[model samples]
Target: MDTLIFVLFLYVLLTIPVFVLLMLFAVLTRSARLRRAAEVVSLSACAALLVLTFERAFEKPLLWIVVVLLVAVLAFGVSTIVKAARERP
Candidate 1:
């Protein structure tokens, strides 16, 4: 129980930055599709984060999977922002 709480605390901490960066990209880019896609994904991630918060048992290695997914999302946003900047008129 305590362990799950700690993991969730960390997840929430990590989620904030990822969400912020995604939101920034959505706001800066003129692509409505990109913004909509990002919003859906990020919101779903938040829902998953909530589910993980109450988990009392699981393979410990799942934490690594969670971190990887979060990082991948952040990396995708970074790539999108870079591409948008380069392609701007």
Candidate 2:
């Protein structure tokens, strides 16, 4: 569990900066591909952080909230990825 948490923490830490940079580049260049990449990265980072939180506080009432949020984020991520794939040239 400790190792899992550490890995997730590291993933979030690394992806967040990449997400931010992708978003900035997308905005500057008006690139849809970059924007979608940024969205995926952001969602992945959010889900990782949420999982880390959920693991650390599994016994808390807040666990339910985290679970709900994690589900929502994952669902949204899947839907967006599918949509992007369908729209690909």
Candidate 3:
């Protein structure tokens, strides 16, 4: 399906920033836990992004639900990293 391929392409484009940020965060952070968290957050966000695209392609009314959930996840991940940074001596 051309639409599916297009959605996949768009998903890759959208996720590139998340991937770069995760890579940078993992490389810059000294804590093993932080690096592992980055991996988890990145993978989860990528999966969510893919789902969002699929939902969008089908014109699903529940697309907003996926968007909200993804935003919440990203916010949680960022907060966790910031909390760790602040607690470091």
Best by TM-score: 2
The clash count for each model shown is 0, 0, 0
lDDT of 3 at 40: 65
Which stretches in model 2 have alpha-carbon errors above 4 Å?
A: none
By TM-score, the better pick of 1 and 3 is 3
The TM-scores, one per candidate, come to 0.40, 0.78, 0.46
- Put down candidate 2 lDDT per residue, 1-89, tens digits, no spaces: 88888898999999978988999999999998899899888888888887877776767876778788788888988897899799888
What lDDT tens digits, residue by residue, belong to model 3 across residues 1-89?
66766676676576677667767776887657656665665756556575655567467767776666767777777677678779888
| lDDT, model 2 | 0.85
Q: Write the per-residue lDDT of candidate 1 for residues 1-89, one digit (tens) a residue.
A: 66766776676667677767767787898666566566655655555564563252255655766656656665676677668768877
Q: What is residue 45's positional error in candidate 2, in angstroms?
A: 1.1
lDDT of 1: 0.63
- The candidate 1 region of ten consecutive residues with least summed lDDT is 50-59
Error of 1 at 84 (Å): 23
Worst 10 residues of 2 by lDDT: 53-62
Q: In model 1, which regions exceed 4 Å deviation?
A: 41-89
